[model samples]
Target: MGPTGTGKSDLGVALARELDGEVVNADSMQFYRGMDIGTAKLAPEERGGVAHHLLDVLEVTEEASVALYQEQARAAIDAVLARGRVPILVGGSGLYVRAALDRLEFPGTDPRARAEIEEDLARRGRSALLAELREVDPESAERVADDRRLVRALEVHRITGRPFTSFMPRREYVRPAVQIGLGGPRGALNERLARRVDRMVERGLPEEVARLDAVGLRRGRTASRALGYRQFLEVLDGLSTVEAAAEATTTATRRLAKRQVTWFSADPRVEWTDFREPPEEQLRRALRRIAEAG
Candidate 1:
């Protein structure tokens, strides 16, 4: 529950081992199968025998839906609780984390309406769609950063006759839980991200992207847009070199980390730990927080 390259995965595994917990993944990009290297997905052995749910559930060609993810993640958490094990929800995807832990409501989509909006987007371009969204729902237009969200905001407005912001989750938790946020200085995080991208390249991120692209990776609405995967896909298309792609990936990843920090920092409930501290100290602080929450 922190920024990328912040050692969240390792901390989650450590916590799971201490608490007899199973991990329910909240990272959206890690949902796709065969996106291992670029996603920094932990291998089975690396999980320290703690079962992980919701990883490798989607094909490279399929789109990821937060509504569906909410259902799946909640079910996984319930099952883990039923088994008398702690359910550790781990990832840097802020919306997915909120959907799993908070009282967030997802409005039903209208296919016909969606199709119409998609047609409009294709015909009129993103600026036109953004302009229309601003006219109908200025808050949503101000918040939305991309085409997918812009289209969805308009579709939701047309379907529900309400502003998209109305559906945003409140800060109230759906259940008792403690969020452990691991973060460090911005310069340190930037260095970590750069090294991580270089490691991904050394571990065959380009090859992994090539294999997934052969299996329709580019067709995926969500998977194709992931940080390293997107940049490396350009490498596959001869639009960039591996070295250049790695550099671009590092930059994009740093930007994503910044956004994640901003999103999570806005929530007052999170108990943050400095990654500059020793790992055992971080774990001790997290365990103490969880105990206090109980």
Candidate 2:
């Protein structure tokens, strides 16, 4: 779970091919139908015959939650494991990853905290709620840099009367897995992101956004919160011009990439590598490491 346009899918695809694995979409927006371009969805041919699940499976209008993702992700993981193939969970969505792995022992959510957060969100807007998260759990607030996370954190704290992150059981969750990361100088990553966004727009990203709107998936859902789509939707809603939408999307995407760098930095398990070479090098290393331990 890194950030937008950080080659998570490319890395996952490369690893899946090497390991006889299936790719599970962990990006929240990618689950919705009509969200292909903005979500940077792989084309059928581009998938290189690699199987992918949990992508383009729902209407954009649907309000999908992390709980729903956990259920679907579990089914996909079980199916892949049953087939004797590795289930490579891949995406930039940290919450989705935590939910799927059940790696986080989220303190039970409290109704009272939920009510208060919702009330604040309703009255003063999301900014206020985010401030609340910042005050209570700075680490969590940093990780979850959006209103959705703020709301979830509130619920978690209310239910447990403790920081939601306490459920993570930190040490145990780090075991039983190997993590590989795309590591480069910050300037290099930013350059890569700029090029990636340019390529996305050239590939009819705006048209993809238009199609989502046509399909009625343009409102009131987690899918709608995706980077490009949300900015483009503002264009679709007359809040911004088309050119302005593109610029806004690019800005938000860069911000996401920056945050991803921070989140992965503390993960000692992740071995940083050059993206220039075939990812097989890292995948094989991880597989060997995991296998040797047993």
Which of the numbered candidates is closest to the native, going by highest TM-score?
Answer: 1
lDDT of 2 at 179: 59
TM-score of each: 0.88, 0.76
* Runs off by more than 4 Å, candidate 2: 106-171, 278-294
Q: What's the lDDT for residue 150 in model 1?
A: 90
Residue by residue across 1-294, what tens digits does model 1's lDDT show? 999988888899999999999999999999999999888999999999989999999999999999999999999999999999999999999999999999999998899999999999999899999989989899999999888899899999999999999998999889888999988799999999999999999999999999999999999999999999999888878999999999999999999999999999999989999987888999999999999988
Name the regions of candidate 1 deviating beyond 4 angstroms. 113-163
Please tell me which predicted candidate would have the highest lDDT against the true structure. 1
Worst 10 residues of 1 by lDDT: 229-238
Clashing pairs in 2: 105-167, 110-159
Question: How many clashes does each candidate structure show, in the order listed?
Answer: 0, 2
lDDT of 2 at 233: 75
Predicted candidate 2 versus true structure: per-residue lDDT over 1-294, tens digit per residue: 566665678778877887899999988878877677777888788887799999988887889777677778889988998999988888877677767764655355667767778888999987777777778777787787667777888788766677767765353342255556665676777777777767778888878888877877556467777888888777777888877877787778888877777776766666666555566675666567547656
lDDT of each: 0.93, 0.75
Query: Cα RMSDs of all predictions?
Result: 3.4, 5.3
